[model samples]
Target: MLRGLATINFYADDVEAAKDWYAELLGVEPYFEGPGEGGTTAYYEFRIGDHQTELGLIDRRYAPPGLPAAPGGAIGHWHVDDVRGTLDRLLAMGAAPYTPLTEYGSGFVTASVTDPFGNVLGIMYNEHYLEMLGLR
Candidate 1:
């Protein structure tokens, strides 16, 4: 049984870079880092968005074998006010374009990017999402 999305973990060969990149994108630094004592930062977490969703970066060194080298499969698209602007900003931040912004009809616009670390980050401007959040 799933309650809700508590966290989304992405693997990166360089956790620090991942942290910095995400910080720049989210406009906030990581709220948590471990395991302390001058330990190499193997993990970093940032609380972001209206819901304060957790976005985590884990060192790929600890990644279990068989994980894909590049991020793929199911994508979780975060709601945004400007899909085109966000995608452009991500690209300017060095994220390669994953999916060009496209309309899914009925006012649903979606796009995605492959972070330097190979994680796919998606953004969407959804009419239904705004209605559900009572924001529209």
Candidate 2:
């Protein structure tokens, strides 16, 4: 019943920093920046990867009430051409490695890193995803 991963949202205490950081990593500026209180940027959105998926960055002040400061909960892995390369780039960009590259066998490999904003960003190389893309 699920269509698939669409817009993935991350919250940052400093949206501007997050915007710039993500822009650099994605190799493109955000297609949209939402205005916030005090004329600050509250949100940034970038369409990235082969699918042009929407990756959103919102000011942490807008996060749901009672959300814990610690990074936990769900980690959604975005498909990438090279998990190891992507992980290396993320680490070089100051992102701490949350999980090292792991071969899951059967053409599945995955890894994750914690972004500067304290969000768990996962990357994966999935054969099924590539097959679907080829079908399209």
Candidate 3:
């Protein structure tokens, strides 16, 4: 099950600049900076309410195979009350299902979707995840 949005991860070309931009946009400072090997390449996290979203900056060569090559808009992430139920609701709402809900671990389930606007959104749920948001 889900309670509220936990986080929205963003892939960025420049982590520092992106952090600054998001800090201004979200009106919050970075609460956690991930470990880096003394270089520009590293992961950064910013908190919005109880959610801690991450921004990963890595070399293009190491980027995932299917992830978007560029950034600028939301790479969707949604929290759900029930992963299966929410997926069905989204389908009824005109969202075409792209992936079926699959359990990962600890009561977590994840699935993907293509919004009407053609943006990819990931939906997820877990009791522990909800607890992390203080929603349990």
User: Each candidate: how many clashes?
Assistant: 0, 0, 0
What candidate 1 gets wrong by more than 4 Å, as runs, is 36-38
Q: State each model's CA lDDT, in order.
A: 0.89, 0.91, 0.60
TM-score per candidate = 0.92, 0.95, 0.44
Best by lDDT: 2
If the candidates were sorted by their lDDT against the true structure, best first, what order would they fall in? 2, 1, 3
Residues 1-136, candidate 3, lDDT per residue (tens digit)? 8864555555555666656655653477777776556555466566543444443333333446887653324435456777887777667765577777888878778887664434455778767768877878
lDDT of 2 by residue, 45-105 (tens): 9998778889999999999999788787898999888888899999999999888899999
Error of 2 at 90 (Å): 0.4
For model 2, name the residue pairs that clash: none
Best TM-score goes to which candidate?
2
| Candidate 1 lDDT, 1-136, residue by residue in tens | 9976899999998888899989888989999996633568888999998778899899988788899996788888999999999998999999998888999899899999999999999999999888978888
Worst 10 residues of 3 by lDDT: 53-62
Ranking by TM-score: 2, 1, 3
